[model samples]
Target chain A: MDLQKMMDLPGALAAFTYSDKGDLQSHVLREGTELTPQVLDLLAHSCVANQAIASMEARGWEALTGQSGFQPLKGFSMVGLEWSVVVDGNCGVVVKNRDADYEATFNALQAA
Target chain B: MHIVKQLMAIPGVVAAGEYAYRGDRFSYEGALTDEFARMASILCRANTLSVNMQSEIFDSFAENIGCRPVQGWIVRGSQITICAVGNYFAFIENRDELLNDVMTIMRAKVGDVQDDLLVNLYARLGGDTKEALY
Candidate 1:
């Protein structure tokens, strides 16, 4: 997803692209935002770990329950005290919790 | 009046329960079989740990950034979604406003989670964290 598009997301303070291993490749931060490159880098790395672990859970859940619809995982979101980060594949966007639309954020991540 | 029972009372809640830090002991109610419940327990533990680690890492980068002391997390799938607050986990079928309702209720019940993931979870289970290895 284009960094601009990600930035356009409601409450979005930043958008970034990360490596499969969670290294932050590039990022765009909104003006006057407290988020720094260092913070975004750490956030990217965490996103990778969390997403991978979530995928594993999804697979195990399907196998154990004999259920479908959870596989091919769309995305993952970590709800923080004041904000949330939504990510899919290698793209992620961080939005303020007050303005976050989790459903929309997930949809955007998948759409990207 | 159990949290699991409260969650199970929701219309679209398929399963709700509490899992131990090790993911070995769990108690739940809903449509899942014994094996499925076990898997869910492990799933919740894994996710909880993952998010907790992430939150701690974020705090290390910058303190009081509002990402620390992680509250919880959600995995939104195509039709099924799993929401976790503290040691409690809920599996719900996606529907109109159901996710928000369940989340609100769970947050209200579980309240805000502490920063120490191991201590936070172990305290709820009445276990000693000092001797336990992460």
Candidate 2:
């Protein structure tokens, strides 16, 4: 896949290119890759993980996305650093930064 | 000199020194000596983890890799131990994983987005310093 095609996915961060397979290997997004019922469970697991962490720190948690209309999850504090991962498509993980260059890299990934 | 260089390589390890690991008590202070748990939070942050979650992760990782979590010091409520005859270590996986885990806990508290970028960049530079000593 080329840069534009790979960037088609919303919230892409970075792309890992491989060799030999001649295709994109991985694409990373800020939120998650899928909204399907299967992924809902994983997303919930991630939420559980976050809640567990909050319990240990005596704090609460929330979630965020890039979409304009998307209401950011409540209970999240705009305080310290945080990270989220989502597995989608050929991409093994998705991160938060969604710059043009990052998108290009994901587009350039080769198949392994 | 080597120890300092190695410790500095870890993402969030501010400092390390000649931590005395006698019997069960450990202490460090000198030109190249530091105490345990002093940088537990920092270390945990760097590794994308927190003090409380590290023990279970480490234990699972040890079991997976067929190693033991030895006794050495306590940092941020997690036990710091040397593995592989004090050559390698048994802690969180890497900086990216650690930072990711931290961000998960913080729930976007700070710069979860930026941190993910920085952590990935640093992790890509690649070379496990904490375990390199082994």
Candidate 3:
């Protein structure tokens, strides 16, 4: 995923890619944002955990309910009090809550 | 109407429910069987715990960057999306504008999640909030 392009998203404070095990791989931070690499690393790890859990839930829910259209998970977002992180696969973008466009962010992640 | 009923009224909302903070009990309506709803309750519990911890960690790092008291979460699958706000969870189809619509109503209905996590949830579930000491 192109971290720079992810940065172009509205209200994006930082965009990052992480390893399958949740180590921060690469990132770009908008200058003057209060975020630090250390925090982003933690965020990356949390994103990974959230994704894995959500994917498992999707698979199990579909199978148990005999439902369709739930496999191939797309993305997950944590809606914080003032900001949020949207993550898909190994990449994620943190956006200011007031400016978050959930659909656009999910589409961007999917395209990447 | 109750919040769960309100959510179920939305066009693409297939299942809506109120789940326990620890995944022990739940009640749901619409397409899911009882066993499926129980699994959904467990899933919501896991996601809630994960996000609450992350919120606390973020708060510690930034000292009130407004990431505290997580409002909710959403997971979008290929054609189904699950959204949880407060103790309520909804599974909806991915038709155009459905996610946004369902999210808007859910957020408006549930309001903000309390910082007193366990206490707030227990109070809502009829437990003694003061004694919980959460």
Which 10-residue window of candidate 3 chain A scores lowest in summed lDDT? A57-66
Each candidate: RMSD: 2.5, 16.8, 2.1
Residue A76 local lDDT, model 3: 92
**Residue by residue across B26-99, what tens digits does model 2's lDDT show?**
22222212222333222323223332133234334333211112111111112111111111122221232332
Best by DockQ: 3
Q: Under CAPRI classification, how is model 1 graded?
A: medium
Q: How high is the DockQ of candidate 2?
A: 0.03
Candidate 2, A4-105: lDDT as tens digits? 454454444333322223233333332443222223233333333443343343221112111121112111111111112222223322233222122222
Predictions in order: lDDT:
0.82, 0.27, 0.84
Off by over 4 Å in 2: A1-36, A59-96, A99-112, B1-43, B50-134
lDDT of 1 by residue, B1-134 (tens): 78889999989999898887677778889988877888788778877787877777778778888887777888888889888888898989878778768877887898788767777777656756767645
Q: Could you tell which candidate, 1 or 2, scores higher by DockQ?
A: 1
How close to the true structure is residue B71 of candidate 1, measured as C-alpha lDDT?
77
Q: Across residues A12-103, which tens digit of lDDT does each residue of candidate 1 receive?
A: 98899999988899999988877888998888888888777778777877876679988778788888887888889999999987777677
Which candidate leads in lDDT? 3
Q: Taking candidate 3, what TM-score does its chain B reach relative to the real chain B?
A: 0.92
Q: Per-residue lDDT of B32-61 in model 3, one digit per residue for the tens?
A: 888878888887877887789878877788
Candidate 3 error regions (>4 Å):
B132-134
lDDT of model 3, residue A96: 86
Model 3 steric clash pairs: none
